[model samples]
Target: MGKPTGFIEYLREAPTEREPGDRIRDWNEFHNPMPEERLRTQAARCMDCGIPFCHTGMLVSGMASGCPINNLIPEWNDLVYRGLWREALDRLHKTNNFPEFTGRVCPAPCEGSCVLGINNPPVTIKNIEYSIIEKGWEEGWITPKPPAHRTGKKVAIVGSGPAGLAAADQLNRAGHWVTVFERADRPGGLLMYGIPNMKLDKEKIVRRRLDLLEAEGIEFICNTEIGKDLPAEALLKDYDAVLLCTGATKPRDLPIEGRNLNGIHFAMEFLTGNTRAVLDKQPGKDYISAAGKDVVIIGGGDTGTDCVGTSIRHGCKSLVQLEIMPKPPQERAANNPWPEWPKVYKMDYGQEEAAAMFGADPRTYLTTTTKFEGDENGNVKAIHITQVEWTKNDNGQFIPQPIPGTEKVLPAQLVLLAMGFLGPEQPLLDSLGIERDSRSNIKAAHGQFTTSIPGVFAAGDCRRGQSLIVWAINEGRGAARECDRYLMGSTDLP
Candidate 1:
């Protein structure tokens, strides 16, 4: 430990963000960088606890409790505290192939399990991680280091999202020829489209990494769907190994009345279109505009929050986010103890922007949509909703019960369904003849990452369902290790 009593002397501090009122005017990253000295002080807050649960990377109460990739947190924190910026970056890259992505978007489960968080605030781990990697880039410490030796093995990775990219980076470093296939016009499948430009700049952040990967000899084939553009059988025959990292992209739909109405869109459709328009520097005719319209977003999570932010930026007349579940407590509940992810209420970047514009949080908890009301043009005009209470069903499972006399209608010219994904689209899996679990995720063991078919592997959301980007990287690295072992009969990837 660099500073044995550092945690006792210093309090935790986080990076400042751009003011909500100012940041919503345009699409740009809201977080302001912390000074190097302050970041060092923050790093010093990492306690010398014998058991650093922050890097344990275990599941507690069915939720991620720590860094899924098992980042060497203490080592990096110590290095950063001692002003070893370059060394810190080296330690960070040892485990995480893409710290920039995770540092920006990951929920920071490691902080949740921080020993310092048991009583006081947690260390600003996420921000420090962001700073370390950005420092690496600025210092010219990060550049393409192509493999010294070639394995002469060709690998095909389907989907260029976080998982696929991580796997490609690992296999390429292992001296294998890796080719990543993406159906989108560009690479970075989810990072390029699913997230807004403000949170993660596609051209600046994502494309920069993609370009670096290419410089390292990995090939990216865009606008190419394997099952459609090219037969799935070709991958198995042409490549020495095939890894499936296609994400769980099938959005859960609300099948209520008037679902066929125009202006009612899936969250991804709205997000993906908006991102494409932003990149193209012009909104297409099909762009779902919230301008001058009362927007109603059904469901709540990162996706729902993004809808709120995007709608506000479009100058929506009003915004209301409906969440069927009750609001979480302000603090950890009785059942949620230390090291478990605290189920507490907090404002995200989107809600902050919404509050600044609308003078409220925008989320209406414990509310369920009954039906979508449409006008003569078959365009959605309003939403019928009702309050609900959690009641035990015959199976002893808690279910939302609609409360009597709580029915209401909210005026809405635009509706976005931001409910989470169900599972991976099954067409590709079917074409490849890969088996799926009950949840429709590709059936593959966690550590082995091997599917029922030989030379075929699965990882990330396609195998584990919708999850944090960090977990996807974890699985991707694991899958790559196993794939390398399969290829060379031994593996050095860690």
Candidate 2:
């Protein structure tokens, strides 16, 4: 440890963010970077715990308890504390292929499992990680490092999200020629479109890495979909092996009476169009605007939060976020102990922005929408909602039960359904004749990513369902190792 008693001496400090009121006017990232000296001081707070559960990378109570990618927290914290910036970057890159992505968006399960967090604040692992990577870039420490030799094997990776990109990087490092296929106009399936720009700067962060990967000899073919633009059979015939990192993107729809009404859309439809409009420097015809409209966002997840932020930027007249689940406790409950992800309430960037603009949190918990009410023009005008209580059903399964006389109508000119995805789209899997699990995810084992068919593998959301970005990277790296082994009858990837 860089400083033995630093944890006892220093209090946890994190970087300040842009004022929500000021930041809502633009589509820029809100987090302000912490100074090197302060970051070092924060890094020094890593206690000398014998078992660093912070990087244990295990699941407790079906949720991630620690860093899923198993980042070397203590080593990098020590390196940062000693001012070994480049060394810290090296240690970071050894485990995480894209720390920049995870550092920004990943819910830091590692901090939850920190040994010090039982009684004291956890170390600022995510901030330190972001600082190290950004520093690496600023100092030009990160550059193209093409493999020394070619293994003469060609591997095709489908989808260019976190999982696909990680696998491509690992496989490319192992001396195999790798090509990534993306269906969207650009690469970065989720990061490019699904996430709003205010959270992650697309061109500055995501594109920079994509360009570097291309410079390192990995090929990215965009605007092409496997099993559609290009035949699935053609991919199998052309490449030595194929790995599917196609994410879970099939959105769960609310098939209510007015679902087909105008001004109502899936969360991705709204988000993707907004991002595309931002990147293009103009809103396209497909862009859904919330300007001067009363916006109602259903589903109280990250997606809904993003919708709130985006709507605020669009100068929405009013905003409301409805969550079916009850509000979480302000502190960790009895069931959620140390190492388990805390089921506590904390305002995310969107809610913070909403509160700054609207003077209160936009979320309304313990509520569910009954139906969408449409106007004469077939445009949604309001939502019929009711409060609900969770009670045991006939099978002892807890379910939401609507309370009598709780129905109310809320005006809404724009409605965005941010409910999560169910699973990956089925067409590609069906076209390739791939096996699917009971949950409709691709039937691929976790550690061994091999699919039912030979010479093919699956990883990330398509296999595990919707999950955090860190888990995608972990699965991608693991899949790459197994794929390399399948190709050469041995493995070196880690």
Candidate 3:
């Protein structure tokens, strides 16, 4: 350890976020970075515990409680503590392929599984990580280092999200010719479009990384859909190995009354258009305006939070977020003790902004929408909902039971369904003749990314179903290693 008593000498502190009122006016990143000296002190707080569970990257109570990419947290913490930033970035890149993306968006399960978190708050590992990569960029230390030699083996990665990018990056570094096909207008499947511009500045972060990867000899083909524009078989005939990282994008929908109303839209439709408008400097027809209207968002996860923040930016008159499950406790429950990915309540930026403007939190827990009430023009006017309670069915599975007499209605000119994704879309999978699991995810073992088809592999959400960005990166790297082995009869990727 750099300092045996470092943990005792420093208190956990995070970078301050820009005031909600001011930040909501524009779509930009809100967190103001902490001073260099203070950040160093924060880095010094890493005790570098003997076990170091922070990098274990294992499932605890069925939730990821640590860094899934297994970042060299302690090594970088000590490096930052000693002012070896360039070295710290190198250590970080040893495991994680994209610290910048994860630094800004990841929920930091590493902190939850920190050994020190058993009693005291965990070290500011995420903040330290953010600082390391940012400093590397500011100093022009990050540069494209194309492979010294070519393996002449070609690999095609169908998807340019985190997972595909990571796999492409690794395989290219191993001297293989790599090509990434993106169905969107740009590379970065979700990073370029799905995420809000404010939370993650697209041009500054996502495109910057893409540019570097391009200069490093990775080929990117945009506006190409594998199953539509071109046949899936084209990939198999062209490349020595084919890896699929197409994310789980089939959104789960609520097929209820008035579903075809004009104001009701999928969360991606609303979010993607807003980001496109921001980038194009003009709103398009696809953009759904929440301005001067009451907005109701269904689902309480990150997508719902993004909708809240975006609606606030659009000057929505009022907002309400619905969650079918009950509110999580303010602290961990008895069954969810230390080191188990604590199930607790914490306000995200969107809710904080909603509270600031609307005078109360927007989330309503234990609720279900029964039907939609719409105006004669086919625009949704309101939604009928009922309070619900969870009870175990005869099979011992908990289900939401509607409580009668608790039915009510709320005004909503716009409704966005932020419900989670089901799995990868089926067209491409079926076209390629790849088998699927019971859940409809590509049938492939976890570490082995090979699908039912020979010389074809899968990774990320397509292989494992919908999941966090960190986990996607993990699968990508692992899949790359296995694919390299399959190609050359040996491998050396991590």
Candidate 4:
């Protein structure tokens, strides 16, 4: 422990976000970094528990409550407390390939499972992690360290998202040749296109990481789809082993009345186009504009939140986010305990901004859209909604029961479906002849990334379904270790 009484002496402090009014005017990041001295005090608050459940990366109560990458949290905390910042950065990089991405996007389940959180607020692990990496970049400590020698073995990674990148990094470090293929014009799979630049600045962060990966002897082939542009047989014939890190891109849809209306679009279509416009340096005349339009987003999750934040930036006239489930409790219930991710309600960044602007939270719980109402010209005009309550069917499955008198109509010029992804698209998996699980995910057992076919493996959202980036990194490293073993009969990778 850095100080025996550190926890008692210091309280948590997080970096303040930019003012709502000012941040809404642009689609840039809004958070300001905390001063170095204040961050040191925050680091001092780490209790450094003997058990250290924060890094366990296990599933607790059906949710991940710890760091999935098994980060050296305590070591870095102590180093930060003693002002050994460069040392802190080194320790963090040992496990996490990119702390900056996780620091900003991850929900910080480690804090919920913290030992100190049983009584007091948890240590500011996420903020400390963010600062460590940012400082490393600013000081030029983060640079490509390509392997000193090559083993002459070749590995092909199908997707260039977080998992594929991490796998390529580790495999290359083990002295193997690694090449990443991306269907998009740029390398990052979803990181480059699916995600908005505001959350993760594409040019600054994503492309920067891609550049370092390239310099580390990892070759990248962009704008090449395996099943389409490049045949799947080509990859199997050329590489010693193939790692499929394609993310879950198939989105679930709501098939209801007026589904084919002009203004109703898939969330990815809207989000991806907006990002492309930004990258192109202009939204232009063809862009989907929410300006002066009432927008209704269906499915309340991270995608929904992104839609909320993006719509605000476009100067939407009004917005409403609908969730099929009931609102979470304000605090943990009797059955709920500490050291697990709390199911209690807390506003996400998008909702926070929405609340600040609208004087109320934009999310509406226990609601379902029955149909889209369109104008004479076939553009979406309004929405028909019905309130629902969870009720047990005879089979004991809780189902949404619509209330008869609760049907109402609301104005909506544009509607974005933010329902979560179903699984990896079937065409690529089918072409490669890989088996799938009951849930339609690539059938790779946990911790055993090997697929049905020999010398082939799967990782990330495609294998595990939609998940956080931290888990993707873990799977990537694990898959690389397995692939290395397959190639050389013995391997050293973590």
C-alpha lDDT of all candidate models, in order: 0.94, 0.95, 0.92, 0.89
The per-prediction CA RMSD against the true structure, in angstroms, equals 0.8, 0.7, 0.9, 1.3
CA error at residue 162 for candidate 1, angstroms: 0.4
Cα lDDT for residue 35, candidate 4 = 93
Worst 10 residues of 4 by lDDT: 282-291
Candidate 1 structure, TM-score to reference: 0.99
Clashes of each: 0, 0, 0, 0
Model 3 alpha-carbon drift over 4 Å, by segment = none
lDDT of 2: 0.95
Rank all candidate structures by their lDDT, best first, as comma-separated numbers.
2, 1, 3, 4
CA deviation > 4 Å runs, candidate 2: none
Which residue pairs does candidate 3 place in steric collision? none
Residue-by-residue lDDT tens digits, candidate 1, 330-417: 9999999999998899999999999999898999999999999999999999999999999999999999999999999999999999
Shift in Å, residue 121, candidate 4: 1.2
lDDT by residue (53-129, candidate 3, tens digit) is 89989998889988899998999999888889899999999999999989988989999999898889888888889
Between which residue pairs do clashes occur in model 4? Answer: none
lDDT of 3: 0.92
**Model 2 lDDT per residue over 406-481, tens place:** 9999999999999999999999999999999998999999999999999999999999999999999999999999
What lDDT score is found at residue 486 in candidate 4? Answer: 94
Residue 132, candidate 3: C-alpha displacement in angstroms: 0.4
